[model samples]
Target: MHMISALLFGAPDAHGSRRRADLVQDLLWAHSDPEDAVQHIRVRPHPVGLEAVLLLGGRADGAATAVVALLGRSAAPLSRQGYTALPPGAPVQPPVPSGPGD
Candidate 1:
């Protein structure tokens, strides 16, 4: 079970992003392999639209295909602009530096 990551763009707003995430999860649950896809998801604000990070369970190509198909049928304004297979334990995002005041 390899780990795959993807970024989905084009969400109207924060609320819309949340809705999109929920819809994605539901769709994946219904459409994808029961135990080999869509492990986790996170949403963040972006200039064009909200960006979502999807952690999937499979090879890069397979994961991308599943996500693309799911997004195509989702009916939400979301598109997978980028995705990659991650090495085990690789950090999805860079670590944030703490301020001195903290």
Candidate 2:
């Protein structure tokens, strides 16, 4: 159960960037898996009106896949936040095996 967390900061354009980011964040949270995948996510406006913060937590691999899916479905370009890879400080959890215990 690898875990990853990311913080996406919006660009300088207040209206477009903030709106797009908010929409993306909402969609991401809506589609997130609270049990096996993303446990939680937080989105808020930044001090700079043009910027925002997106905090997300989920399985590392799953998070990566979700991010890709989100980007693929998005009308706006998420590249402005330099989202080429996962953010720092993401924790990886050990996998849980399934089996019948004696």
Candidate 3:
């Protein structure tokens, strides 16, 4: 029997780096990628919701792959050709206006 550590989970930093990292968790709480070395990380808001896209480099010099979070705590790996770098959704639509007259 295997038990996953709870400390490994969290609201990941949508914008951060984990270069040559030993531990990289996908948006989906799937298996922890302790084998591969994480080269890059990109988090963007999609139509479904916000997610993290992990760019991984193989440990023993394998080809790179893009990993995304699915429905739950699980990850789906994709090829570079299949992955799309969509523009991040805007956080705020219209900025609140403040006048000199308090």
Q: Quick one: best TM-score, which candidate?
A: 1
Q: Distance (Å) between predicted and true CA of 53, model 2?
A: 7.3
True lDDT of residue 87, candidate 1: 28
Estimate the overall C-alpha local distance difference test score of candidate 2.
Answer: 0.44
The C-alpha TM-scores of every prediction are: 0.45, 0.35, 0.27
Over 4 Å off, model 1: 1-36, 76-102
Clashes of each: 0, 1, 5
Backbone steric clashes in candidate 2, count: 1
Residue lDDT tens for model 1, 7-46: 4434245556556556555554554455447776555544
lDDT of 3 by residue, 8-37 (tens): 222233443342012233432243354434
Candidate lDDT values, in order? 0.49, 0.44, 0.32
Task: Report the candidate with higher TM-score, 1 versus 2.
Answer: 1
**What is the alpha-carbon lDDT for the whole of candidate 3?**
0.32
Give one digit per residue, the lDDT tens place, for model 2 in 1-102: 333444444333555665655655675565444443444444444432222223335545565665445434432444444322223344422224358982
Least accurate 10 contiguous residues by lDDT in model 2? 47-56
Tell me how far candidate 1 lies from the true structure as C-alpha RMSD in angstroms. 10.3
Query: What's the best-to-worst order under TM-score?
Result: 1, 2, 3
Q: How many clashes in candidate 1?
A: 0
